[model samples]
Target: MTTEPQRLQYLEAMGLTAWTARYRMPNARPTEACEWELPVPDDGARQAPGERLHALLDAPAEPSVPAPAAPAAEPRERPPAGERKARALLGGLVPEAASEEAAPGAAPEPARSVESDEPREALRFALQVACLDGRWLVVQPGQAAPSPLAQRLLANLLRAAGVTPEHPPAFEAFHWPQIEGLDVQAPLDEARQGLGAFLAGRARRGWAPERLLVFGDEATLARVLAIDDGRSTALDLPAWQGPALETLAGSAEAKRDLWPRLLDWRREWHGEAKGEAKGDA
Candidate 1:
């Protein structure tokens, strides 16, 4: 059995106003709120629950009273010092700097510069040096070996000058960024030094050539020889710079240009040799 207050609460939840009797019957038990009373019609006619609900719905609603204003709450106290520090440490792990809203009209922080300690990329270059028929020929084939067409053209050019080198000519291939290991910082300087030493060692051994023929970039040859100009006799030897064999093989104009230079160089160097041979004869 539900109590009187619970029964009243159920009726109130159903949108119906509950009423209490003003006077209690002789055999009725006392209610929890004995002093409180509500005047209700005591007509002898008892109505069903549905009829009572309908009558209550038909009745006019009472005027509503405004609730009293609540007092303002006090400001909350700060958390303990240790708790605040722990929260700060946790927040520091994963920084929210990027997520933070930027201030209006404020200058942004400058970007940080990253410094690298690794060695710079190795300098890349390719060349071939050969000693042919008592003459040094510094060639920049731009690869391991010259193309067959370039090689054939070179042989024809040499033959035109009436010079014959030994079969299987001695070739020295020099390439930069060798070994792909340590101690290769100054590659350009190292290349110049290594080539210079090779030439110096050959000269010391009494195999110094009387002439120098370069079939590549003159500027590059000059740098390797530590000379101001490739055409000048700064190395104490007759020198001539000509187009690369690759260029001569493909272009008729290049071959035509090279023929005259080849003839002039051969006459100057070979003529001296011939005159010396005549005197010796």
Candidate 2:
């Protein structure tokens, strides 16, 4: 049987207010707090023995307040005598400055310069191209267009190779310069993987050429080969079996050196020359 407080808690939980319907005897004093027993269900519709026991066990338990926890122990202080002795020993072991007087004929060691810890500047350059058919892809340092001088130089190179700006070549040019937002200073392996994928996609779309004329600095070539030796030379790409000519990127001098080489390559591609196309610079 529950107490008066428990009964009142249950009634409150059930959303009902409990009150006593008191009947006062004439001249009788008020009684102390009273508890009324709740009516039990009839045994005719009785619950199973196990179920009754489970209900009794599952009833809400009385809440218990926890006792206060013990305070933590304070850390021990260090002994001042030991600390002072350590300080004294360290003071006694002080390294004296080297003697100004050098041993006879003994050469002094050269002072080593301290290297800067600052990161080196990122390599920056644009790979630009001008096709025989007046199509231009002029990538600037920051992914912008090539200057007019650069475009004119490319045009002159194309003319040297017997390609007129009015007429497009039979084969589609491999457009490497049009790659947008390319980080030139990205890790070699990562850049090569991305470039390989790009090349493969272009090849799938019938953009594979017999020969690719890559005009870029040593760094660009290194990016293509995924190496850092600064050697720029012809190598076969995964997408194309033909040679990819790596030439110097900027300036009129570089273009002048490249035109004759491009002319020879164009001749070989057209079957005009008897020997193999010498695409390597």
Tens-digit lDDT track of model 1 for 1-281? 44454344334333346666789999887776656333445785467655675565455446455457855454253322343434444454433333135567778878876733444554556677666754555455466677677677777887776566664345566654443454444445555544544465555334457667767674454655543354433455656776777777789998778766655555554565656644643
Q: State in Å the error of residue 40, model 1.
A: 99
Error of 2 at 85 (Å): 60
Q: Tell me each candidate's TM-score.
A: 0.45, 0.33
Clashing pairs in 1: none
How many clashes (backbone N, Cα, C below 3 Å) per candidate? 0, 0
Q: Write the per-residue lDDT of candidate 2 for residues 1-281, one digit (tens) a residue.
A: 44454344334433356778679878988888988654456755466655675564455546555556955554243222333434434465433333344466888878886843333333333333223332321222223344455455555556666545454333222223233343333334333444344444444334443434444334554455432232222224211111122223334465555555665645644557435444432
Candidate 1: regions farther than 4 A off: 1-123, 166-170, 184-187, 200-207, 218-222, 225-228, 232-237, 271-281
Q: What is the C-alpha lDDT of each candidate?
A: 0.56, 0.42
